[model samples]
Target: MNWKGVLDFLKEKKFGLDRKELVEAETSPVVPDDFCAEEVVYEMNDMGEREAIERFVPPTRSTATRKPPARTKGHSRGSMVDPRTNRAITFASAHEWRCALILLASPEIAEVYDQPPAITYVDAEGKKVKHTPDYLAVSRSGKKCAIAVKPSRRVEKSGIVDTLDRIKPILGDYADDIILLTELQLTHERATNAESALQAHSCRVQADCDRVAVIMSGINGEVNAYDVAKAFGDFPRGMNAIWCLVYDGIVKLANPALMLADHPFVFRVLQATSVAA
Candidate 1:
């Protein structure tokens, strides 16, 4: 064994020893403790800096100011299901409920919405104020209207009349018209009967309407309650169907002032020709 020759051969062969030493030297760099402390301070000062560089910074979703919701009148609120729209209509008081029923029954009315947009007006003190109307309605002729329900006494009291007078023109610009509907309009016995009739004869299907229309055409003119009921085979159903026609404008009552309880109630077909046409 030549020892000098053996050492030279091992060095020449390299034997993976030199490569392992080089890799260890490259991986383990000497880091200073003071430099590590300074890096920790930087990360503490700007915690989001790393996140900002590596990923997207989302926007802050916050409002500068908060507002409370508008308050409604403190009254005994009630709700009724409107047959025309089949929607639950809410009213602040009994007067409002009655007015809603009237609107539902009106042939002139096309649609009704509760708690319509707030109307802004300048008060008698020259201060700006907002008034939320009770009901907003569109007419058969495409006229927009705002209706305020109030008792007759309250209409004069609380300066309501004055306020409405001032707000009329303002509302008229946006609506076709604005009207104060007091108990005078809503509390009538005829109106009550009309509402009852509407409730009893709430018809939504075209088949019912077509059947009613045929009966009205056969009558060919104004007919008494008995005749109309008889034409439809005279039952609780026939009476309801007839009143439905009256409420829908397909038939017109001659004396709306008279209640349905009145004997020999008269009604004429308004849409007979139109239905034929």
Candidate 2:
């Protein structure tokens, strides 16, 4: 058949077109744009080039006045991320690291600066001496405390306790208070609890925290922590919130020595004999 006869046959077969439509489609074939074989011209501009670099300021390292001293034989040196500010806190010894953890765990403490600048003062013998505190802790209330941490054995031999006592008056010029912390103060329980508190503080589940807050709000006296945790339907999440409340001093653990889940606590009342370090 001829093209016209074929178009007529397609229409008769109901191929979705009439003879007039078929004729228009066959005549209106798509035509490509005329090709320009010459190489295309290009333009470039430096509008935003280096804009980010120009606006950038190299971040300042840290506000800490001095860095921790070099690691010597038999001495430990390291850094840990502070959960409060998410900054690294340097330490010269394991004791210092534990001290930092304890201080960071405290809600009262705003920041802990390691290796604060040396404090020079005259000892009782009238000789000038320099004492570099292990850590300088700033409380939320703006109180500055210079901390000297040492092992119980070293405290007496090093005479750090006496040294701090003698130079405390002079150090007062630098910090509001001079604290001497020995191994006696930094116990295993306190350090463990501090670590737990840090983890609890970092918990980001808002729903679990809100549920805990609701349970705590209704408590006027002591309550079983496990029961409160079970109320959340998810025991682990509920317990995390309870730990957060304890970490924040919103609750007082009765037997802090007990495991996190076993402790009974009073809401909104901070106890003198509490777990805080």
Candidate 3:
């Protein structure tokens, strides 16, 4: 059968023939294919070139079977973090790894140095861990990256061993670009594992932090602009400087963001604590 005749018939919607009769002709027959094609061409040509070229449209219910409407899945939810843009710093959470990052983004020391490199912390399981390096500093000589700072009392031969044990992977991975600082001094061998890290933290004490206190007090919150050298001092055979954690060109910090962001988590955390009280 001629598909053209069928298509033209569908388009013109001409089903029944014009021929009929009361009793003489008896009934109307389907239009002949040749006649239908001829009529289609004649009608189309009469409309001229552009009009004669038919447009294509998907078959609708009148011309073809229609499918039901499709079911659509909706979008997921968004974060409800009341913008903490200008909120207070969360000093308590400052001890936590991830939360401290918000504090680091605002470091005063950072201003003195180039920005910290993008940092990422990952666990042994290959899952990503979030940590703000404690310090990253730069000098004419080179760069540094400090992952942690242990109070002086915390330094022990074993302490350094454990300290290096835990943080070295990150420091080593981050090596040559940073200088890890701590109250405790360590032999190259001791600073290698978690056991050593724990030992280091154990030695830290209120007095161990006295040097840091002096330097910190002197900062006057002008970290990005302050002279870090004022905080600089020599350590005992095992004593470390306050800038110990300085790494690469950026001075990383436990709470850099607190020093950096307009709304540090310290104020926010304090606000929450105050409200709770």
Candidate 4:
């Protein structure tokens, strides 16, 4: 066998290959986690009597070959490999680092962090359609806050106004409360502009309305203030936007695509600040 072929074989074994090398070694590999069917059978003695027959046993899977936990992979995306006790700072793009931070800063939000957020109310045909938001986390005071999370990079085109329009009704009188959470990793000006437009569209007094709060991501750990302040200091990304609806409940748009809680970073963030109340 040629030396080239030997290298290829060793690469296929994944003995010491990096992620890129392993991927390149094989164009595609069977996904290990997918489950499939296997035949199971029962055995019986010639006696043919139920009491005399030996029970058929299915093959037992060996725990040694079992898949380990997700935490085993260090440096993997969304892995909370931070050795530190408090995760006040971390980097997460897939789960949008913003979602993790809000749950970190506000121990009060962990209550409804697990629920899937959905648009509870819609105004498509001048008629209200009721829908349960993905998150209906309750406050210590028995108030309900509607939550939705997405990357600031992904908040394109679907603008916050559209999101607010659909979800504003959750802030209706009957609703104990309505809270919108937006997490974006974008420029300070862009983030502020996007957020300011959402509530400003509606007038004041009614703007300061009740049962509704718009919460936005304050700042991502990736972009340090010094890096941002070199350009726009006072205008640094608002990071978190928590607004209590006063007027008619202003409208906003929040896409649920690519959102996840299973990530370790997300899990840890929620675990750290889990709402005690």
**Span of ten consecutive residues with least summed lDDT in model 3:** 268-277
lDDT measured at residue 258 in model 3 versus the true structure, 0 to 100: 27
lDDT per residue for candidate 3 within 60-169, as digits (tens), equals 22110122123335212111110112111121111221222322322222211112343455555667644433334332334444444333454463244344444556
Ranking by TM-score: 2, 1, 4, 3
Sort the predicted structures by lDDT, highest score first: 2, 1, 4, 3
Backbone clashes under 3 angstroms, per model:
0, 0, 68, 41
The residue-by-residue lDDT of candidate 4 on 163-228, one tens digit each, is 556666546643455544544333333333333332322112221221112221233222221222
| TM-score, model 3 to reference | 0.21
Model 2, range 142-178, lDDT digits (tens) per residue? Answer: 8899999988888768878767887677765578988
Give the residue spans of candidate 1 off by over 4 A: 1-76, 203-209, 272-277
- Error (Å) of candidate 1 at residue 204 is 6.2
Best by lDDT: 2
Question: Could you tell me the lDDT of residue 60 within candidate 3?
Answer: 22
Q: How high is each candidate's TM-score?
A: 0.64, 0.68, 0.21, 0.28
Compared with the true structure, the alpha-carbon lDDT of candidate 1 equals: 0.61
- Where does candidate 3 stray beyond 4 Å? 1-118, 152-179, 185-277
The per-prediction CA RMSD against the true structure, in angstroms, equals: 35.2, 24.5, 35.8, 21.9
| Lowest-sum lDDT 10-residue window in model 4 | 260-269
Best by TM-score: 2
lDDT of 3: 0.29
> What RMSD value applies to candidate 4?
21.9
- What are the Cα lDDT values of the candidates? 0.61, 0.66, 0.29, 0.32
